[model samples]
Target: MNSLTRWVRGPWTNPTASGLLIALAAIFSFTEGVNPFSDGHAEGAGALPAALIASDLLMVAAAVVAGTPILIKAVRALMTKMIAIDLLVSVAAIGAVVIGQYWEAAAVTFLFAIGHALEARTMKKTRSALAELVAVAPDVAVVMRDGKQVEIPAAGVEPDETVLVKNGAKVPVDGVVIGGTGALDESSITGESIPVEKGEGDEVFAGTISGGGFLQVRATGTGADTTLARIIHRVEEAQDAKAATQTFMEKFSAWYTPGIIVLALVAGLVTGDAVLALTLLVIGCPGALVVSIPVAIVAGIGRGAKDGILIKGGEYLETSARISAVALDKTGTLTEGKPYLTDVTVLDPALDRSDVLGWAARAEAGSEHPLARPIIDAAEAEGLPVHGLPERTEPVVGMGVIATLDGQRVSVGNLPLLTVEGIADDSGAATEVDRLAGLGRTPMVVTLDSRVIGVVAVADRIRSDAQEMIARLHDAGVQKVVMLTGDTQRVADAVAAQVGLDEVRAQLLPEDKLTMVAQLKADGYTVAMVGDGVNDAPALATADIGVAMGAAGTGVAIETADIALMQDDLLKLPQAVDLARRTVNVMRQNIAIALITVVLLLAGVFAGGVTMAIGMLVHEASVLLVIVNAMRLMRRNEDQHSAGPAPASDARELQTAGAGPLS
Candidate 1:
């Protein structure tokens, strides 16, 4: 029975099904020759109309047979406030038939159901994009230990354990590379068109593709701590959030439906015309009124999906549209969040670049630091031969690396290491290193035989998409976009300017970000903060909306966020806002049209200008009108106008298409 029920209620619930029944009934009605008008005599003129009404009634019966469970569920939901408007609309539809406006009632019910099914189908399509993303998350991880490989549950992986990631495998945890190198496909993570090269010590997000070489990664974060997990969680939370428009509609329906019924009853009593009363009832059904909000919501969600934005629910969709300001956390939001080999300065003119890089990679090997990874990667790429250290290496926390190579003392770190070791200042090397560091670069100092030889400057590269996304947001409706970073002001400003951000707040701690967000709120602005680190959790919680970049299936909890823009693509933020705004506008238009139709139809009957049959016809027409109008949401892309010259060009192209060749 469950299988049968599923079959009947599945893809079969569509307008085409109802339309077929309606068509069949119309044919039967044409054969009957009954009058459509109540005033027509039974002999000739009325037979066709009467037959038509009978046909419509047959179609309605067919619909009730097919939609029995839906009707029951609608009733149950309304009783429980699970679904409000659908319940009242269903009841009103039945009341129209009980009052003898069979065709009017059937038409209203059929149209409403069809519209709902369409809305559901469209919404499902829109939501499928996120489902696709969810489907890609790895359920298992490959753990490597003591030269053996083992597959384990992704959630079971622990921090600091080496995990073997092979080609095409989804990263199961956030970790830094310890061995091997590979090209990673991060399109899903960053929304960029290119793949990124990663090597030892470079941090890779869970769920991104390790495209080529095998890698051994030491897991730093797992389970709910992964960025991807946080994104999925945030998306779900956002979906559950409600918007003001939905709330108003619920409140309106509570009184609106009952009021219509009472007005119809009053009209019936005063006019002493039962048929006129029935027409009033038919007009007051609110079929279109019930369909308005959901259709717009479905359409908005669909639009977001097309642009790679996944908004979990209508509530998040609504809130995104109302945000006034957006706060971007610098580390991963505006910058690449990975160190890249930006520059190499050789102080000892005789020291070959390749040799220096190889020494640096071997010296920094096994260190879980961002700067070390790029140096190692650069050495490997240059095919520089790296030899194992002759003696054990000691790590100076917050300083650098100290080791012995070929029985000679060697240290590669920062200026602090030289100052603390009582080594000669080497003013030339110090000045050059300071210049590089000042430009947002991390300078790795190399010391051989107790003297500084060279400095290799590495910096976290800015993400290719960051600047474009920021500009897109401004174009899409964001009033201002700002970057907040813990990095030096010079580094933050450099990245911010390149990314087209309106402002920058640099050298701020996680707490500082929270304070800044609070101040913005105090200023009466709605702020959306985007971040993807544990340090960002508090600010994410405090902002008007928190967007976590867990597109790679890492970082699963964004408890503070009202809306979670699931993918790392910052552009989705702007796309979602536009989708929300357009959806609200469509909903408003639908409600207005539905309300006006009901009011005008009731006025006609009360003024004695409309008969029961005319009232029913007009009432059904309004339902049809609203259904057609709601369908217009599906075409919103055509109606969507860009802000400037782009839309003008589109308009011209549209004009050309419309003009065609001269007839």
Candidate 2:
């Protein structure tokens, strides 16, 4: 069909045509002194009565223009052996015209047509978020094909191909940066507005816009294999999947529509009252009941997607509403995953602070342990000389490293390594190690030439918003926030105290973490486990909800995690929970409104004061009301309240309040 023809035949099309025809008909009826309710004659032999004839003709034309599509839909539905609301509406309008109620016929068809158009427009607004996402999907990509840059459809880009993305261009595939650097705005994928810096080996996702830099990315995924595609697919499935209440309503509606038609037939035949039976058919369309849950689900899921929270489905939303306890993996979740040098204590007065730090950095120069970077960074920051790797280095599996530097023995590790090297703790180095460990710092004793020199400590700094995030989780109805880590008891206690945790599980291996999560579930707690490492995978899977933090760049996390918080912000956890609770509340309210409207309409129809036009109006209004209620979820808060950085004094107070007997 041509565009105009298709539009004219559409359910929501050409409302202005129906509206203009109705207006003309009303004006002509008034001019001829025609009372539609009084069976006024349009065939009287006079010029004045001719105006009445024009009014009746106009009304019939308006009814036909607006009601033809509805009749066609009714016929198609009948061919399939099913009845629909359009069928009910068509029957009522046609029956009214057969009885010479031209005004009623025109009014009912016009109102139904216009209401449908408004409903379609409003529903599009409710789904605006997903539409916005689809709009940003990249259409083309620039790839280095045969060493020459060529543009191709984004879906046509082959895996492992090097794609070039310039400033302000949307990335066309999921890939890792192999050359150059750039900042990418990943808000479409992660809901974070900030542009994340990308460097060599950093991951980038499709549909993310590059910010002010050139990048050569090796495409790992394109088209349907990309993370953005998966997210969109998941959201669509979530919105389409019927909730339990919706399924029940659907089952009720399946019988309700046909039952209403049967009742209409019986009522008309038994009472010989055609108008009353037509009124019954119009009122019994089940409009609100059929639409109540879907609108809410679409709006709720769309809102979450806009905020960078991905709910698996409506069923998950229901489950999320009851979450009481949250278990968090310490590393990369509550703390910055990167460790930094915090304390450098001198044990030997002969050796200066720089000497101890330089010796430790030199010993760790060739090491690949995570803690080594901070020591080297600190040394470099202070302009200390750390030129070359050690001539010979021996690493103890769980202890530390022993290296021979410049013909002298230099060791950097825990006390166990020092003991293995026969270094005595006579200088009270053991006490200092204990003190640092008690303060949640990982202490490494430095020894030179078989003599204890000093101690260097590194600790993962707690995120500035960690305390406030826990506080907000409690406010959001979370009963307890537990800290789980492989760190020692003292370190775990220190962090737990700082973050206001209700419980702490320390020195837990990967399997131990899993056990703790299972234990929480066994204790009847709806647990949400938040983590960001491979070791956490087991615990994350074991929890009721697996939330992956800083998941924007990780395709696996985005696809697999039950709830993936795109940013590393601690506050998103509570925010996700709060959103789930709000969505569930909206769903319940919509269902209640829908059921009540159905009950009241049915009662009004049986009580004998309702007419066909009024019944259709009430039914349409109820559907609109349910839809408007669902659209409320799409409304963003004017002032988004986010957890800001806490002051230094607040941190001190938290540390004091959380301190244990050791303090």
Candidate 3:
């Protein structure tokens, strides 16, 4: 019994069968141009001028072939206590048959079946991107177990196992290259066309193909824990999720289908025109309108996933499109997050660059601070030995470090550290610090026994694509690009100016960043915050959209961020924004197409021009038009980064983005 119910509920309807039946019906009807809707009634009971019996038999057969599934679906909807589109199509087809309009019944059901078949085929194409992604999942792995290489299923490999990836082979797991070297075609993971060089200690993900060279990777994650699996899972959930407009359309379809049935019944009772009433029912499926928003959203999100941008769902996509202001964290996002020794300026003239750098390195030796490494690294690079740790190292939060070396007080810190130590710098050292900071270099003022010696500056090099990202944000219709950093105001301003940022919010801690985002939202700006997705969690949660950069290795980043750019490339941020805007544009276009088609069809049905067959034809055409329009998003992306300024966003729907989903 259960098997029978399931079989009946499934897509048991075959449009091809109906097509063959309709062809025979059209041939036997002997009407002009093979029109099936024409009745071939005989002049007399004994006469055979019309060949009426044979024609009616073929038409009824076609109607039964097409309408069986519709009736089954309509019966299921009745059991579920709902008024579905199938119910409307079934009722109209049955009504035509009751009134002896055999050809009309066959035509209506045949057109409806064909429309569904076309939608199923085209929508499958729209999802081709995701299907391609799933197809890339690694199937086999060569693992070094018990000191011998053994082949096994990809999912059977255990964590921490060393997996071998050969040239032109798929990487079987997300791991680190502990030995060997290779380049990977990470286009599946990062959407980068060029294969990335992977040396010892470089991270590699599953689903990437090796271009050349062999690599032995120690797996960090296996099976569903892999980044590729996570991406596929996220995309599947996103496609199934509904957008705000799609939800509204569904509710509208629910009542609208029933209302059409009610209107048809009233029209038939008042005017006694069964054909006109049946025509209304035939056109009242809401086929295009019901699908307009979701098909656009699915295609758009699927397209982004192909490019390694993972948007959470419809709400984030919609909100991302309205992002007028973008807030960015400084470290790791704008810059490389690794400060390097850029300059060493001597203020005392008594000592050279080596004296200043040597003292700074000795003072900061073995220090874990981000700035300490650059100074120590530079001193060693110039053959200056930094063998021992400083005797005493004091790290002042948000200020530079002060350490004691060889019992001589050595201070290597920003200008504020001098004030904190009550030390005097009258040797023109502040002027040198200003000079270096003005050029976007973070200057560390060096002091020896309360005497200012020289200033050694180390700055995190801005990413190569930072400037391009800022410009592209503007081109994508973002009105403002702001920098929020814990760096001092001078350093922040310098980086901001070089990047052409619209605003800079410096000296902010993690919580302060959240307050700033909330302020932006309260000011009626749709704000998107881009960060590392961990330290910036508060701010990211408070913004309209939270974008995680370089999220390939970070599972939490991929899972939690509203949108995750798999690579560290800054250019993907602007590309994501551009895609979101394009997606919203497509959704609105589909909506407009659906609404216009409905209005036109309704007008045609009420006027005397449209028959039941004509109404079904137009209805099917409109549904196909909507599906075809959405498929445009799956086309190859244009130059989204350098495109002209985009259309202004609608802030009304996204006003409370920081609070929750699109209102």
Find the candidate with the highest lDDT and give its number.
3
**Candidate 3 structure, TM-score to reference:** 0.91
lDDT string for model 1 (1-663, tens) is 699787676755544566677677667755865433232222344334555656756656745643454567677876786644455445545655566555555555565565456556544654454565577677999897677788899999988888888998888888999999998876544444367888998888777887798888999988878766665554444444445676677677777766766776787688776556555655665656765676566556544543435566676667677778889877666655666676677777778777566667777775655567677788878887655543768888778878777676677787778875678766477888767655556667887767777777666656655656777777767887887777666666556555678888877888999998888889887788888747887887888777756534433433444444545655566656666777777777888887887788778767877654355456556655655555554453532334221111211111100000011
- State the lDDT of candidate 3 residue by residue for 23-60, as single tens digits: 77667666534345565353235654354566777778
Clashing pairs in 2: none
RMSD of each: 10.8, 4.4, 6.5
Candidate 1, residue 606: Cα displacement in angstroms equals 4.4
TM-scores, one per candidate: 0.68, 0.86, 0.91
Ranking by TM-score: 3, 2, 1
Error at 216, model 3, angstroms: 0.5
Error of 3 at 242 (Å): 0.6
What is the lDDT for 593 in model 2?
78
